[model samples]
Each structure stands twice: as structure tokens, then as C-alpha cells.
Target: MVGVGYTLMCEQTGPKELVEQAVRAEQAGFDYLVISDHYYPWLDAQGHSPYAWSVLGAVAHATSRIKLMTYITCPIRRYHPAVVAQKAATIGVLSDGRFTLSLGAGENLNEHVVGAWPHVHQRHEMLEEALQIIRPLLDGDNLSYSGNHFEVPEAYLWDRPETPVPIAVAASGPHSVALVTEYADALVCDNPDAAVVRMYDEAGGTGKPRYGQAAICYGPDEDACRKTVHDQWRWAALNWTVKAELPGPESFVSASDHIRPEDIAQLVPCGPDLEAHVSAFQKYVDAGFTDVAFVQVGVEGQPMFLDWAQDELLPRLREL
Candidate 1:
């Protein structure tokens, strides 16, 4: 069976509320929870960006059964790979082997705050170097390493779980898919694009768990859900290239100023129709994603969505 997951979007929800939701998600029958690690919200209207690591720590204690993971963290900038290893190890220990570390090349939106963002090629190279240091350290290996993009002098994790944390890499294109096949134990994507899975499998990710994220707006009124998605998640309708380079929420708002609610309605699964939600999830499962995470776009209706999902959507998705 494909595992169903929930996205804990730190960019929209406060830390305390996120933890409370994590507990609720566990009770709602989610197999796992993936939290976004962001220093800033993608849009100002989203209104929140708490430190994800601190929130994950609280979640570790608050929920006992649900799996925990970083949807994607960029260790190339704003953080050293060694520090990421420490954080991953600590969370793994806290969650008792239920933590996963998902990584990416990162975006200028968050990393630019630390310094000038590198070119796309350079960032990928940096991520490669970062992973070289991170993977070993997560396994409790002492590493003294020097690479073109990173340097570490005898660093290791002392609090690692008995099982090393699984490392998943996010990839939206051929180059990144190649990286995932080469290094990651799992693959993650924001879209249910079949090309990604096909490339991963042809390149040797056949049996690995593939995670895909889908956006949904669950509410009683279809039009209201569409409006909410437009108000909050229209940033998603922008091309990935645009999203990677924009430096702040204001930039996102300005970039998406021309977007309309109908555009979001076409992209995200909207409203109370159980089939709409189930069919949306089916796209990911059909594309061979072993794990699918639903990103409920708006702030409200989490409880209603969860209850509805447990009662209706999940069973239908399992049938698919």
C-alpha cells in the first residue's frame, strides 16, 4: 500500500499550532509527516515561518507513532553540512529511528539571506559535497574531510539513533534525478510527474520509496477553496525557475500578482468533493510514488480535512 503523508507547512502555521497538528495528523491516520524548512514564508499572506528544527523537536515528543521528515532542507547554504548532520541525528534519536532527512540544492529565497546565492550548477555541486559529509556523519562515522564546496575537521554525531536516518533527495529534473539515483535512499518531488519516476527507475531507483507532494484545498464551498488557494498558494503556480530565484515573500506576491483564482482551481484539488481529492492523490500513486503527501493549501479546515480524509479519501486512494 502507498503510504499517505501530511505536510506541516511551517511557512503558514505557527510552531505550537504545527505541533498540535502533528499530533492530530497522527491520530487522523497519516503514515508520516513532512515539514517544510524555511526561514521565510513564500508569500506574506501565509504569515508564519518558525524554525523547523525546533518545531520538529517538539513534534518528536508530542506524537509517538507518526514518522517525521524534513520535506527538503538545503544544507549548501545558511547551514553547514556538519550542523545538518547533528540536527538530523538529534531528531532521529528523538523520534527513535522515525526521522528522514530530505535535502535539495536550495533556493535563493532562503539561502540568499546568508550571502550571494550561487549559480544553479554551483549549488548542485555544493549539495553533492554537503551530502558527502552528511551521509557518513549520520551513520556515526567520524569524518575529517575537505571538498571544493565544504570542509569539515573530524566531526561526527554522538546522539544518532541505532538505525541511521534515511536520506531522501528532492529532484524536479533529469540532473537531480540522476543525483537521487546515485546518492539518495529515496526520491521526492512536488509534482506527480511520471517522467521523474521513469527516469529514476531507468537510472536505478526502481525499488526505492518515491515521495510526491500534491496540493489540495478542502472546504465546503468550491469557490471559497479556489479563492483560498489563490490567496495562499498561487506561488506554486509559478514556474520552479521563478520560485528558485525570488528572494522574499514580497517578491513572490509581486511575481504572482497577475495570477487568478481560476488558475489555481485548475492546479490544486479544490473543495469537498471526495472524488476530486481522491483522484488528485491517485495521480501520484499512478506515477509509482510509494509515498504521497497532501499539502492542504489554506490555514483553516485542517480538522475537517483530516476527518474527511480518514473517513473518505484514504480508503478510496487505497483502492486506486
Candidate 2:
């Protein structure tokens, strides 16, 4: 089934408001709630970056049917593996096993607070180590293993789900996809290019579920949607310029607005029409993405975006 989702940015909205929004998304016909995790917002925006796990806890009680997830959280840097394991377990239990852990090596915006970004090779190595630590903890198995990057003492989690909440690694490039295919049960990516999405399927993944995501404004009018794009999603779009290469350990230096569009344009669909949105997402479907999560960010006119998404966009997906 094709499932619709929303991004919970820790911003102007509070826990109560977010729950309302989550419920609203459900009421609007979306099937999942994706709460984004960010330690800090873009410097200029000064928006609230709420602790996503806490919000998900509230959302758990608030929404009974919709699946919940982290749009993509960096397991290696922003939080420790133990913390990730515990939180994932808590959310899984809270949502009655409707939680999926979407992860990545991390980006400069979030990981820099911990230290210099690990080199690309090291980042993958770090993620692999993180998975090693997280899996057992989530399974309620005692763990005590030491790795080149991280170490965990004799620790175990008692409060875990009855079944493993499928873990999805958010990957873009071929290398990361291959790495995650070895460990992760699923793959989640914001990039919508058919070829890009196919890379994941072509890699080690055969029958695993895949999630494709994109930024959308969703309003009835074009101008309103554009405003949302500039306000929210642009934080990632502005400085996506990859003059050097895909970010890695040494390469992921601190950067903002400097991010170039060429890098992310293929990932974030532009335009105000519903057809464009469908076309962009269809690429992912054509590439074998069975699950698609659309973040209703970018472009204001809140009611317009949500209403159409439910009444129009969603119904069309039914046909697809």
C-alpha cells in the first residue's frame, strides 16, 4: 500500500500543537507521522527543534492508527546508541509497534556539535558499529561489545517491543545503500530521482521495503506553497551545493546557505502543481519504492495544503 506521511519539525509548534497536527494529518488521511530530529535549526530561522522522541511519545497516545518515525536521525553523533535503542523501544511500545527507526551517519548541521564529522569511510564504519550496538538492545538482549568507534558495557534493555520495529537506514549514494543493505531492514531517502532510487534496489536490497520522500507545499495556490518552501525546506536546499563531493568525515565541514541547489534539486521537487509532485514521487515508485512519505513543508496556507493532500493528492495515489 502507498502510505502518506508528514514531517514534525520542532518549530513554532509545541507538543500539544504537534499532537493536534499529527491527529490532523491522520484526519486528513495520511498514514504516518514523521517527527524530525534536529538539535538546532538554521541560524536565521530561530525555530524550535524539539526533542522528537518526546514528541513521538505524546503522539503515541494521541494517534492510534498512524505509523510513527524519525524522518531521519543521525545515530552516530547527535545521540548515543544506548539512547537511540532506549528511545526506539519506548516509541515502539508507545505506538504499539508502529515505529520505524530511520537513520543516517548524520549531517554537518547536526553532528558538528559532537565534533568534527567523521570521514565518509569512517562514518559508514561508525554507522555499522552503531547498528551492532542498537540491534541487541532493541531486541532486549544483553550487549557488551567494543568497537573502534564506540563501546558499550554489559547493558541490556528490558522495555522493548514484542516484535522488532523495522529499522530503516536513510541513504542516498550507492556506497551507503550497500552498507545499509547488509544490516538495515529498509531504506528511506528524500531523493526522488528514479535512477537514484534504483541504486538502492540494485545494491544488496532485493525484497526489503523502500521509502521515498520529498518536500511539498500542498496549497491550492502556487504563491502560498512557495512561501512554505522558502520558510521551512529551504534550510536544507540553500546550501546543498556539492562543489567538492558528497559529505563525509573530513569533507563535511560546517556549511550553511552555501549549500548549492544542484546537489539537492534532484531530491526536492519544485513547482506548485499536484501533477509535478506526483511525477517527482512516481520516479521513486518506478524505481521500486513501495512506501512514499511526503513532508508537507515549504509553502504556507496550511489548510489549503492539508485539505488538498487529503481530498486530491491522496485519492490520486489510490489510483497509482
Candidate 3:
């Protein structure tokens, strides 16, 4: 069965709104929640980036049934893997084991604020080491490791969950896919690529949950939907390599300057057509994704979108 989840774009909304949305999503029949962890919004127009962990704490109390996870968190920089393990453990306990920790190599937009960003291979190496440190700690074991990129000095998680919080690694390439297969409990990607699933399975990730994301704009006016998507989500069209390297929101704005409304409309399902929205999600399902998260593009249309999803889109997807 396809697990239809909602994407809480912390970059696009404040903490209070995020918690509120989580409650609404659960009520609307979304099976789980996937939230983005970012220090900055992709564009100034997208608006806010509250600390995702704190917001998640609020979500845990406010909603009870829905499973929660970071769409992807970067533990190699800005945050040590130890701290991430601790946070995930505490949140898991607080949520009564309804949380998963989704990790990635991270992007320069968030990590570059601290210091010079490393090369792609170097970052992946760091991530591998981080997973090494994180996995044992989450299992309630004391860890000691000296790796090329990280050092864990006899670390232990005092507040770990009884069952370790599952780690879902986000991968967009062969190397990352292999890393996830080796280290992660689940595999995550944003696009509908069957080859990614095949690669993960071939690399020993068979039977693990495969998660993917779909971005859409739901509104009555097609023109307005196109404009909203262009203004807020043009960054969606950038390749992961470009996204991983760009320094800040300004760089993203410049990179997306040539992106037109039609360009965004073509990529993201826009307007209020039910079939268009259903088809957008179906692509990921067709690509063999077991879990799919939907990100609504504009704030103004969120309520309508959720209502429509509960009344129309979700039931249709469930039938598949």
C-alpha cells in the first residue's frame, strides 16, 4: 500500500503553522508527515525557517497518530551526528516511537554559513562516518570512533528509544544510494526515478521503505498557481548538484532568475484539476515508491488543498 504523507515545508511556514498543519494533515487522512530541515529558506519570498527539532517537539504533543520525520537533515555540518542522534532519540521518546530520522549529505545553503563547504565526495565520506557514529548511539550503545572526517569519543545516548529511531538516508546518485543501502533503514529521494529504486535494491536495500516527494500547487486560478509556484518553488527545478553547491538564497534567486512561471508549472502540478494532482503523485507510486510526501506550494491555498486531498485525491491514491 502507498503511504500518502504530507510535506511540512518548515522553510515556507513558521513553527506554529507547522504544528497546526500537522494536526490538520492527520485529520485529513494523510498517513504521515515529512518535514524539511533548513537553516534558511530557499528564497526570501518563501519566508521562514524555524528550528525543525523544536517545531517537531510541538508536533509530537499536538498530534498523536501521524508518523513524523525530517524530509532530510544534514548531520555532518552545522550539527554533529551525536547531537542529531540525541535529538532524534528524545523526539522518538516524546512521540512514543512515531518518529524517523531522515539524513542527507546536506546543502551549502544551510551548511556553508559555518565555514567552507567540502567537495561532494568529501561530504559523502563525512556522512558515512556520521552514520557509523549515529547508528550505534541510537541503538543505545556507547560509541568510540576515529574516522577520516569525524571523531566520536565514547559517546552514548542516555535517552534512546527502546527501538532505535530508524534512519532514512536521502540519495540522488549511485554513491549515495550505496551509502543508504549500507547504513540506512530506509531510502529517500525527491524524484520519480525507477533506476534509483533498482540501484538501492541491487545494493542490498531490498524490502526497505522507499520514500519520494511530489510538489504541487492547488488553486482555482491556473495563472495564480503558476505565479505562486514560480515565486516560491523555482528552486525545485535546480539539479541536486547546483542545489548542494549554491551558497545562499541570493544565489538561488539568481540561479532561478531565468525560470519562468510556465517552467515551474510544467514541473510542479498546478491548479485545481484533481487528475493533475493525482497524476503527479502517481508518478512516484509508479516508480515503486512505498511512501510519497506531498508539498503544497502556496500558503493561501493550503486549506483548500488539504480539504480537496481528503475528499478527493487521497481516496483515489489509496485505491491504487
272 Cα displacement, candidate 1 (Å): 0.7
The lDDT of each candidate is 0.91, 0.71, 0.91
In candidate 3 the C-alpha lDDT for residue 101 amounts to: 98
- What is the lDDT for 196 in model 2? 49
| Selected candidate, larger lDDT, 1 vs 2 | 1
Model 2: residue 289 alpha-carbon error in angstroms: 0.9
For candidate 3, write residues 78-146 as lDDT tens digits. 999989999999999999999999999899999987889999889988999999998888999888999
Candidate 1 ranges with C-alpha deviation above 4 Å: none
Candidate structures ordered by TM-score, highest first: 3, 1, 2
Query: Which runs of model 2 end up more than 4 angstroms from their true locations?
Result: 11-13, 196-199, 202-204, 238-272, 298-300
lDDT of 3 at 246: 94
TM-score of each: 0.98, 0.85, 0.98
Candidate 1 local lDDT, 62-104, one digit each (tens): 9999999998899999999999999999999999989999999
Global lDDT for candidate 1? 0.91
